[model samples]
Target chain A: MVEVEMNGTTPSVRDELITEIELSFGLLHKAAANFDNRYISRVFRDLGPLRRKLAKNGDALATVIDRLYPHNSASRAYLLEVTGKTDESMDEETKSAVKPEVDLYIHLLVQVYLLDNNRLEELNKFNDKVIYLLGSYNRRSLDFIQAKIWFYISRTKELIDDLHSIRPALLSALRSATLRHDTETAASTITLLLRNYLLCHEVNQAMNLVEKTEFPENAGSSLVARYYYYLARINAIQLDYSSANEYVIAATRKAPQTQLAVGFLQAATKLSIIIELLMGDIPELQLFRKQSDSLEPYFMLTKAVRLGDLKLFEEVLKKYEQAFKKDDNFTLVSRLRQNVIKTGIRIISLSYSKISLKDICIKLLLDSEELAEYIVAKAIRDGVIEASINHEHGYMKSKELLDVYSTKLPQDDFDQRIKFCLSLHNDSVKSMRYPSADNRSDINKHNLAAKEDEMDLLKAIEEGDLDDFMD
Target chain B: MSLQKLTAELYQLYDQEEYEKCQKILTPIKLELIKHNLLLPTVANSDSKDKINDLKIAERILEIGALSSLLSNNYRGFENYVAQLRPFYSNKQIHAKPEKNTDQTKIISLYLLYLLSQGLVSKFHVELELIYNSKQYNVEQDQYLLFPVNLEKHLMEGNYIKIWKVLKNDTNLPCKEYGHFLDTLVNALRFEIAKSLEQTYETIPISNCKGLLYFPQEQSDATFESIIKDDLKMTGWTFKDGSITFKNDDDSHKGNVNPNSINLISNVLSYAERIESIV
Candidate 1:
C-alpha cells in the first residue's frame, strides 16, 4: 500500500481520479435534484477509494477542477490559486454555472488532496478562503458538504499547530450552523470545537461550551459518539466519574463497529477502564486480553489497581508515565492513588472482620496508622467499604455483609429494566416509518389491495399515535 | 476621566495598598473601555502593533481590577475581572513572546486558591487542566502557581497531613495575596478532617480529636464542641467524659421505615384490578 501511494502522480492515476470525482459529481447532482441526502452519503461512501487515489496522485485534483469549472470563474480562480502550481491549467471557455453542492464537494476534495499531500501551509490558506465560500453558500443541501469542509479546515489548522488562529472562524461557524437549524453542521462543528478545546487542555471552556449549547437530538450517530467521547473526557477531568463512565460506555456502544473505528474504540476502552478504577470498581480481566499491544500499559495498570497494591500501582505509574501522559490520562491515573488505597482498605475489610489500624497501615504502605484510619473512614463515607474505624481502639471492623436479595436493590434494578424496556418499545414505535409517496406507489398501488385499511392506519399513526398508545 | 489619568491613579492607589479606593475608581475606567470598544479584545483589534498596545492597556486595567478586588476581599468581583482578562491572555497579543508574566501567574494562582478554599474541586481541576498543559505557564517552576497546584494534589491524594503542613507554614506562602486564602483554606481543610474524624472514631479523647482537626490544644473545649456542632454539622456526636463519641447514622435509621401497609395494600389491589380487567 505504501509503495502504491508512493508511486505518485502517474497519468493513468490522474485520469482515474478525474473519472471518480466526475462520477461523484453525478451523485451530488442526484442528491440536489432529488433533495435526498443518501446520494450524498453514497458520495462519501466513495471517499475511501478517492482518498487512496488522491494520495497516489494529487495533481489530478487540479485537472478535475479545470474540467469542472469554467474559465475565469471566481471559484475556479480561487481554487487554482490556492491549489498551487499544477502540471497544467486547462480551462474551457464556457459560461456555465456550477452547482453550489458540486462547488463545496470539490472544495472538500481539494482539502483532502492537500492534506494527503502534506501541503499544510497551502491547505491552511486554501481553507481560509473556503470558510468564506462556506459562509456565502446558504443552500440547505450544502449542509453536509459544508460540515465536512469545516472538518478539513480545522484539521488543516490543527496540523499547522495554529489552533488559536482558527477559533474565531469555528465559533462563528458553530453559531451559523445553530442559527440555520443545520443539525449535521452544528454537530460536526461542536465535535470539532470540543476536540480543539480538549487538545488545548481547556476543560473549563469546553465545559462552558457544553453548558451553553444543546447537542442536536437528530445528529448522526458517529458524530454523537465523538461528542459523547469528548463529554466523557471533560467529565472525567472534572472528577465526575459516574457520568463519565456512562458517557464512555455509550460512546463505545454507539461507535461504528468497523475496523476503521478501532482507534476510537481503543481510546474509549482505555478511558472506561481508568474511570472504573477511579470509581473503585476493577475492570474485568477480559478487557485486558483483547489482543492489542497498545493496551499493554493499561493492562498492567489495571492489574496493579485491581490487586489493590499501592507499591505495584506506583511502579506501574512510573513505568507507563510517558504513555499515560501521551494518552492524556496521567492526571486521572494519578488520582487512582487514593482509589488504590481505598481498594486496599476494602479488600482488608472484606477479609478480616476486625483488624488493627497499624496492620491496615502496614498492608497499604501508608505513612501511619492515623492516615490509615482517616483513609478507611473516608472509604466508608464514599461507600467503598462497609466498615468502620474505632479510633479509640485503633482497630477497624467490617460490618456484616447483607444478603443481596433482602435489600431494596433488586426492586431498583427491576424498575430500571422495566423503564429501559419501555423506552426501547417507544423508540421502536416512533422510528417505524410510513412509506413515502414515491416508495409506496408500487407496493401500495399494486401489491396492497387493502388501500383503505392502509389509509386508516396511516391516519391513526399521524393523528392519534399517542391516543392509541395511552389507552 | 481619561484612561491614562484613571490608570495612573489606580496604580498609585494599588501601590499605597488602598485596594478599596482602586475598586471605586475601576468602574468608570471599565465603562470608558466599553465606550472605546476596547473592553474585550476582538479579532479586528488584536493584530496590528498599535491596536495590540491599546489592548495591552485594557489588559492591564482588568488585571488591576482583578488584583484589587482580590485584595479588597471582593471575591466575586475578582472572579468577574479574571474572566474578563482571559480573552486578553489568550488573544496572542499581550505576552505573546512566550515570556512569563508574574502578574498573570499570581492572579491565576489566587483564583485557583480561591476555588480550592471554597471547595470547588471540579472547577479547580478544570482550570488546572489548562495551566498544566499550556506551554506558556510553567506550573512546577512558578512558586505562585505551584502553591495551589500542590494543594489540589494533596487534597486529591487524601494526604491531609501534607496539606495542613503547607497551609500552616505562613512563611512558605509566595505573596501577601496568598495569605488571604489561608484562613478559609485551613478552615475548609479542617472541615474535611472533622467529617472524617466523625466517621473514623466511635469514641476518642477530645484532645486527640482536636489534634486530628488541627485545632490548637490551647483552645477551650467548649469552643471546639460548638465549632463541631455548628460548623461541621456533626449533630449526632456526643461530647462527655472528656471524650467524643461518634453516633453511626445508619444504625439509628436502620429500622425507622417499616413498610407502609396501606400503600402496599392499595398497590396490590390496583394490580389485582388490572389483572381482573385483563381476564
Candidate 2:
C-alpha cells in the first residue's frame, strides 16, 4: 500500500473509502467475469461491512454510493469499472467525464440483470434513477448518449409491459436528437414512439404524434416501413381495410430485404392478408409462401377465407390457436368468421344471376330464411355484391358486369393518392427549419441595409443626382 | 422523517385523492427502503425482525400507492407497484399478505377491470392465466375476481342482457372503485347490443328495444331514443309513438367492403386458370 503523510494535505476519509470500494469492485469484476459464484457471494457479503465503515467515518458519500448502487451485488462489476478513477487527486473534468459513463454503465448493467431475472419492479427503480441522473446532467450536447439511454429506458418499459410509459421516454429521446440536430435518430425514435402508442391501442395518440411530429422526407427505409406498418395497424383497428391494405402494401414494398427485417416483413404480410380478407379480396397464394413455415397458419387462414369455408376457418383457428394467441392475433383471427360468411355470399351471388333466399339459407348454413335475407340485404347495401334483394319475391338478382374500367372509382383512388401526397408535402413544409431567434440580428442588419439604400436613393433625388442614378 | 410517518402521510394524501403528492412523498421513503433491501420480505431478509415489520409497512404503502395510481389513471405506476407486490405474494418464504379489506384480490379485480375497459382481451387472458398458474388464491370464492371472470365470459358469449343484469343487480362490487369500471363495462355491453341489433333488424318496436337494451322501466322512451341517436350515432332512426324504424340505405354496408372486390374475383379466377395450366 502507498502510504501518505498524516497531514492536512492527506486525502479525506471519503476519498480513502472510495479507493477501497474501487479495489473491491476490481476484485468483484474478476469474480463475475469468471462466473465464480462463491467469490461473488463473498464480494456481496463484504459490501455491508464496507458501507458500515464509510458510515462510521462520517462520509456522506456512503449514502450517495448506496443510492447509486442500491443492489450493490448485481451492479458490483459495473460500479467498479465506472468509479475506477474516483480518486481525490483526479481532476474535476476527468471526474465529470467518468461520472456519466459510470451512471450509464450502472443503468445498463442493472437493466441487464433485471431483464434476465424478470425483476420489473427493480427495473422501474433503476428507470427512476436514470431519469433523475439525466435531469441533473443536462448535457444536451451529448445527444447520442441521451438517445441511447432513453432508448434503453423505453425498451425496459416495454419489457415490463408498461407500454404507456414508453411514450414519454421516447419523446424525450426525440427532443434530445432534435436539440442536437440529429434528425435520423429523431425520426427513428419518433417511429418507435408511434409504435408504442399503437401497441397500447392508443390509435388517436399515435395519429396525433404523426400529425404533430415533423418526419423528414428522406427517412430511412426501415423506419418508413415501420411507420407504415403501425399506420396500417391503426387503420385496420379503425375498420378502414382499404387504407390499411394500401399502407401494408407500402410497408412491404419499402421493407428492407435483410434477415433481421424478416420478422417485420412477416408481420406486414399477416396484416395485409387479414386486411384483404376483411375487404373481401383474396390475397395471392404466392404472398403466403414467402416466409415458408413461419407463415403457414396465415396461409391456411387465407385458404379457408378464399374458399369461404366457415368450418375450415374454425378448424384452422383451432389448429393454430396457440400460435395465434402467442402472437396476440387470435382476436383478429376470430373476426375472420364473419368475413368467411360474406365471402360465401359473394361467391354465391357471382355464380348465379338469381338465387332464392331459401336456397341461400341452405347453401350458406343459415339458421333461418329471415337471417339469410337480412345477410343478403346487408351485403347488397354494403356494396359487397352488385345485386338487388327482391324482398317480395324472396330472390336475389345479381347485375351483369359492366366494362371493368368504366367507373369513377379509379379517379377516386387517384384523388386519394393525390391528397395523401399533398398532406405529406404539407407536413414536410411544416417541418422545414426556419431562422431562429439567434439569426434575427442578421435579418435586422439586412433590413437596415435596404433602408440605407432607400435613404441614399431619396437623397440622390433630393440633391438632383439623377445623373448618377441613370448611370 | 421516519418511514412510518411518511407512510402515514402517504395514506392520508392518497385518501384525499392527492395522488401526485402521494407519489412525491413516497419517493424518498421508497428509495430508502429499497437501499436497505427492505421494500419486500425476501428470503434473505425475512429473519430480521425490523425488516419484517418494515416489509409489512412497505407493502401497505405500495398497496395504497397502487390504488392512488389507479384512481389517477396512472396505469404504469399502478403496474409497477403491483409488480413489486407480486414477489411477496408469490414467494413462499415471504408470507406477507395484505391486511383485511385491502386485499390482493381487490387490486387484481381493479386491474382486470382496467384491462376490460381498455378492450385488451389478450392481456386480460394472459393475466388471468398468470393468476391461475400462480395458485395463490381461491379465485372462485373471491367475489371481486369472480365478477371480472363472469363478466368476461358473458361478454364473450354475447350475453349482453346477462351482463346488464350483473351490472344492475349485483350490489357487491368489492369497493367503490369498481363502480366506475362497472359503468364502463355496462356501456360497452350496451354498444355491443346496439351493434348486433342494428345488424339484425331494419326496424324494431320501441318497447322491444327497451328489453333488448336492458333499459330500466323508470327510464323514459325519449331517454332511450336520445341514447341511441346521440350516443350510438344511429341518425337513420325514426321514433314514432310506439315503434322505431331504422332507415335502410341501399348503399350502406354493416362492415368493410372492398370497392375492387369484383376485380379481385376476376384476378383470382385468372390465377386459378394459370395454376391449372401449369399443373
Q: Fnat of each prediction?
A: 0.49, 0.00
Docking model 2 quality class:
incorrect
Please give the clash total of every predicted structure, in order.
0, 1
| Superposed model 1: Cα runs more than 4 Å off | A1-12, A81-95, A432-434, A443-471, B1-12, B28-64, B91-93, B96-101, B251-279
Model 2, A114-160: lDDT tens digits are: 44445577667677766766666643233333444565576678767
DockQ of each: 0.41, 0.04
Interface RMSD measured for model 1:
3.4
Best by TM-score: 1
> What is candidate 2's CA lDDT for residue B277?
48
Evaluated on chain B only, what are the TM-scores of all the candidate structures, in order?
Answer: 0.88, 0.76
Task: Tell me which residue pairs clash in candidate 1.
Answer: none
